[model samples]
Target chain A: MSLEASFADEPAFVPYLAAGDPDYESSLAYVEALARGGADAIELGLPFSEPIAEGSTIQEAIVRALEAGMTVDRYFEFVADLDVDVPLVCMTYYNLIYQYGDEQGPRPFVRKAAEVGLSGFVVPDLPAEEAGPLRDACDEFGLDLVFIVAPTTEGERLERMREQVSGYVYVQARLGTTGARDEVSDYTERSLARIEDWDVPKAVGFGIKSGDHAERIVSAGADGIIVGSALVDIVAEGHENDDATEEVAQRLEDKARELKQGALRGAGDRPRVE
Target chain B: MSTSKFGDYGGQYVPEALMPAIEELTDAYERYVLNNEDGFIDEFRQRMRDFGGRPTPLQYAEQLSARYDTDVYLKREDLLHGGAHKLNNALGQVLLAKYMGKERIIAETGAGQHGTATAMAAAHLDMPCVIYMGETDIARQRPNVFRIRINGAEVNPVTTGRGTLKEAISETMRDWATTVENTHYVIGSVVGPAPFPSMVRDFQALISEEAREQIQEQAGTLPDAVLACAGGGSNTMGTFHHFVDDSAVDLYAVEAGGSSLSVDEEAGVAPNSASLSTGEEGVLHGARTKVLQDTDGQIMESHSVSAGLDYAGVGPELAHLVDSGRVDPVNVDDDVALEAFHRLSQDEGVIPALETAHAFGYLEEHHDELGDTVVVNVSGRGDKDLETVIEETMERDLSIAPDMSIFREVGGGAL
Candidate 1:
């Protein structure tokens, strides 16, 4: 089933994971745990050398993964072992995709992704203006190319993105890079309101840390709630403690469940404009 | 003209949060800089003359020319107000930012020349400025750092990836993504996403424009070739711009050959910062340029005796120029550059920044191959490099004479 179809009944809870964090086997276990913990979709991070949009948490996670010998092909091998029912999307920088394919361009990457049962892509650095090549490649491979809309986006750009985007639109929770914030900014509310009329499935991300943060975003009319740094922080803590693989997986699954429950509380409470 | 491509080289590859700001900059640049509708062009030229000390001399280097057996003329950018050609773009961008109603300015510098120039311009424009520099660069380029702080701008030290120019650029871009509403990013080179490479080249093009006229008036003919060192390719682009269409004139861009381009069998460290000669096509720091990267496309750390030339990538425009055969790319090792640095100082009484010394080093080696008349862009003064030069000279005196075969191994043979 399409990921968008799964969002129709509830505010979908999507948890993000940096691939090969700690190790390949543990990361795969975390994906399954997220699915079992009520994640409607999974956003798997393909580690790049430089992840400018990410704050220190995700940045460290990427560094750890890269040091562990994570590559595009290895990432696919890990994903092939997943048995989850939730849709899985890869979030990465554009350079990886640009260099992934054979001489035929990004088609090889997209083709491999589709063959591996991957749902779509969320490239933060590939803004709508520079997404033509990737978008075309995704189209050829029957995969979705998701684009993001930030608090600073407006006017023709918003409309243009609304028309071009597929799968779902990523609504950034604030004006900054990804990190857990104590409180969600009012800017996210305004951005959500501004784009609510676009008639697209929107997932609010980039600062949604807790169930309360997820509740606030779903209440503000987000079709889905995306959490990244918060989950990665748990995995990082587990690594620091040198916990057993199952123990870390258990902790991540429990947090995913808690955030999913929070998203459910605001499932039908879409904001009504005056 | 609105497109951000130099023959499939440059583009805005930043996050969505920065797209609006990039678009606004593109719009402002088109309206004010390219169109020059509101007398901004005239004001810019007037400021160049009155503030930046423009119409700098086209000096004929008699002693150096005699030594090299060629008619060598120097476009004396070292004599500019800020001691380097950096002020040309700094002053222009700061003015454009003011015209756009931006109250704060941000910049990234490698060797502190661009930071000092930006700080000076910000002080003149009465805007709060912040300059990001790598910790390694800050330690090496201390004098320029002091000059920046004295100019009333905050210097933010970056300690991330490799702690150098590339990391500083990443930090500045991250800062701009959040503070785009009231800030302008005055990039220090002919690199970055869009509008920037084009915009910076347009501002620095004065070097070529003035040199083209001055060389004709002084030497009675256009030079056979123009040479400038390529760090981010700003100085080279400025020096090569006016003569691009002059089919008879050749353009040479020299990059740093750090320790050596060839790997040391015992140490295993290869030469650094020779992106054009030894790098592959990839995207980095916003533009698709030739970058020194590993097989996995990860950006590798670059090395150079000169902080300004220690970058893993070249400007996308220069990458295109290299691919198109319009510009000949050359590499000069640290020892050769040091030799040229001392020779130019002793012969012409003009000390050049280590970065600029690379161009002179190439000319000194290939003088016989160059035509009768040649012009070299003296991009900066060597004041900031005095400490580094002194330290290197002392070290060389203490150690054995270095092997000179690395020069012939990695010189202009590729060209």
Candidate 2:
């Protein structure tokens, strides 16, 4: 399915999981589970060694993935083998994208992502100001280039982001890095309001954990909800407990359904806006 | 989008969440640093003198000069407060944070020199400070960790991704992103997104600013060559900034060659911190610079016996300088650096930090090639490196190193 179509009818449920988090086989199964659990789209993390945008939870997940021999080559192989219907976006640092292939630019990575059926990208380190190369490459590949809009982003910077962002704008719900939190940020509603005019689905992420967080974010006028570290927590728990892959996959799938349903319920709660 | 650049090297490559902070920092850097708004530069200089013990000596090394058959001088950054040049930038940043009305300060450190210096600055400035140190570094540099805590700054352990400077930087960036409204991230080196590379260099440029004048007054002319170690290139940039316009003066940035120049691609490890000597153009931390990465474009874990010089990337301005042929990038291996560490202690009656030893090792090899008058930046004192040196020294069979360790492997003998 096209990535844009995922948010066309209703609030989209975008679940993020590091590619090959525990191991290749188990991680692939977990991703397929999320797809089975009604994830409208998925952010497949290409684990960079330095994930500055991540908190401890996702950091540990990336460490585990890197330790499990998850290189870019291996990541592509994992992605190509996965037969999920949802659109997949590669979430990672800009280095992995800029340093890919022989030409020493973003084009090669963008072309490779298109070849691997990646619908878009969410480079945490590549702000809209320096995203020209990747944006042009994504345009050439007919892939979307997503940018995050924080609560602090406003004025000329917001307009620049509005021009470049595509597929979906990942609205950072708080000031901090990506992690799961119990309490919702007071900044999320204001952040959504700041980018309300941008012509794309606004997916609020960072510190989103439960189905309730998902519902509130969607109810706060977000067209989508992105859940990351919470899902990685399950992966970490399963790995730590040495639980069976099927058991972890079952848990991830169930959690995905809960979050997706919560997002749908939030769509019902949103006041009808003209 | 109007961020400063260093010939296409420096730019704001940070996450969008950090753009606002980066913008604010850029504005502050220009207003206070460039324009000297509110006499910020005046106050910063005053504090650097009163608090940081600036104008560290440019001592002429008689023994080294005779041995190398050249006039060798040491720009004694080691004599500075906090035992390193780190205080210059740390105090500058901490003071600037005050001017920006930032209530708190945050920084990252690998070897703990920068952390300790920053902690001291924060204390002197009466600001709450937190330093993110990699768990590995916290264990390796316990003395410095304690030093930071003693200064009343919190030492938060970063436990991810090999637990080193790179991880520490990422952790600190995370903290800054959250608390940017009231907290200022005093980045340890001249790396990261613009105004950091430029601003930190401006703060650190005093090294050259003093050395340049001292050489003229003491030796009657600018030194023919200036040498300094390059890790994240804070010291290197500081040493070379003023000399860039001097066409005749040679600048050499000595990088850690570690165990080998080769990398373990499958394991994603570069057994060296020689990013400027052998690195590809890529973004790391927040700027496009020379970085050590593998075929798949993943940043490889960089290694150096000296924790201070162990980083995957160098500063963007340093990269630009190297690419433009203004600054020469050289390296010395771990054994050579250790030997120099011992030689400087015994020969010159001064023990240099492992990071500083890199420059000495380079000088030992290529002193003849460097012009008659040479000045090396003694980046830091060796007190912090005592444990690391003893451990590394015992493992090597060096001619200069004595039996510093009580417990040594039988075959691995020291002189």
Candidate 3:
């Protein structure tokens, strides 16, 4: 399914997983499980040595995946071979995209993504202001270039960003890096209120973990919710076992199911932001 | 959409959260620092004179000139208040932060010279300071760490990504993104996004300004060339700024070559932080500068005996200058820098920082080809590097000749 189609009826439930965590085959299985569990979209994090936007949890996950020999080409190969129905989005830093074609340009990277059937890209470090090349490349390749709007962004800046963004906007729930918090701050509600007039679809992330957090953000007028570190934590827990593929996949599927249910409940209780 | 650029080398490649902060910083810099309409320039100059010991000496290195058969002058930034050229930028940034009404300051340090300088500035300005330093750097540069603490700044040790300057910068950027409301990130070099490279360079241009006047007064003409070591390239930019418009004066930037410029995969030894020498054009640490990265664009870890000269990427301005053929890039290996470090101390009683020694090393090797008059920026003092210099020199002496003569003579029988 396309990302736009997934967000048509209900609030989208997107689960982020670092690609090739533990192993490629196991990560692919987790993607399949997430798709089966009704994840609207899956954000496959391309492992980078330095992920400045990430907190310790995601940072450790990237390091583990990289140590297990995960490369950008390997990630594309995995995506090409995966049998998942949900649209897959590659989330990473800009350097990976810049270096994908051996410094030629972002064209090769976009072409590879298109060939692999990837739906979009979400580069945390590549802000919309500096996203011309990547946006143009994504446009040429028929891919979405998602832009992030932080709680710190306001008024004219939000409107300006809305114009550049193609896919759903990734709304940050808090002011800090990607990590889980016990409760969502009031800033999310305020930020959502500020951008409620925006025409673009919004997916609140960062510090989002539980189903309740998802419900609150969606109730406050978000079109979707993104859960990353929490899902990665489950994978980390499962990897402690001797043989963890099935167990990890099962846990991921269960978590995706719960978050999807929360999203559905929120969508049912409140009118869609659109 | 292009926030800023030094040719095609710099831009705001940061997260959306930092856009407003960067804009605010740019606006404030344009109004107060650049225009100087608010009397900020006069106040800054007075502070530099009273607190930072401005107009650092431009001493003619008589012994070095006699040995090299050329006139060698040293911009003696080591004699500045904080014992380095770092204070020029640090003092100016701290004052700008004060002008912006920021009560707290954040900075990153490699060898801790910048941290010490920042800490001293913060203490003088009566502001709270937090410094992010690599854990490995904290261990090696103990005196500098102590200096930072004694100057009333908190030192947060970063243990990620090889525990060096790059990691420290990343951590500092992250902190600044979160705490940008009331704190100013005093970037230690001519790197980072937009206004930082330009702002830091403008503040540090005092080095070249003073050196230009002093050199002209001492030599009755502009020097043939100006040389300084390039890590993040602040001192190099400062030393080369005034001379940039003067086409006759040659500019040379010496980068650290560590053990060697060639990477030995078999021995697991990576080439040093010679970005302009061996790196390709790429974005790193918020600027599109020459960076040491693998084919996949993963930033390679840089190696150098001097922590200050160990960075995978250079400043965007220096990258532009190198690309434009306005400034020549040179590489100095660790051994030759070590020799220059000792030579400066014993022969001229001027103990140079390891980073500064790289520039001297370049001069030692190519003084004959250079014009009769040359000015090398001695960017920092070697007091913070005593331990590293002693340890490395002892090891090299033992490996070379097993003779204690050189050590005895240099150490003045203290050993």
**Which sequence of candidate numbers ranks them by TM-score, best first?**
2, 3, 1
State TM-scores per candidate. Answer: 0.93, 0.97, 0.95
Candidate 3 lDDT by residue in tens digits, A1-274? 3677778877999889999887788888988888888888889999876687787788878877877878878888989888988898999888778887744668889999999899999988887667888888988989998888887888677877888786688888887688878888778878778877766688889988878777777888788999999988887887876556887788888888888888777777786435
Output the lDDT of residue B376, model 2: 97
lDDT tens per residue, model 2, B39-62: 999999888888888889999999
lDDT of 1 by residue, A233-271 (tens): 988998889899899889888999889888888765665
Clashes of 3: 0
List DockQ for all candidates. Answer: 0.69, 0.86, 0.69
Model 2 docking tier (incorrect/acceptable/medium/high): high
Candidate 1 contains a number of clashing pairs equal to 0
Native-to-model Cα distance after best TM-score fit, residue B247 in candidate 1, in Å = 1.0
Ranking by lDDT: 2, 1, 3
Q: For this target, which candidate reaches the highest lDDT against the unseen true structure?
A: 2
- Chain A TM-scores, per candidate, are 0.96, 0.98, 0.95
Against the true structure, whose DockQ is highest? Answer: 2
lDDT of candidate 1 over B237-290, digit per residue (tens): 999998999989999999998887753322213367898888778888888888
Scanning candidate 2 chain B in windows of ten residues, the lowest lDDT window is B406-415
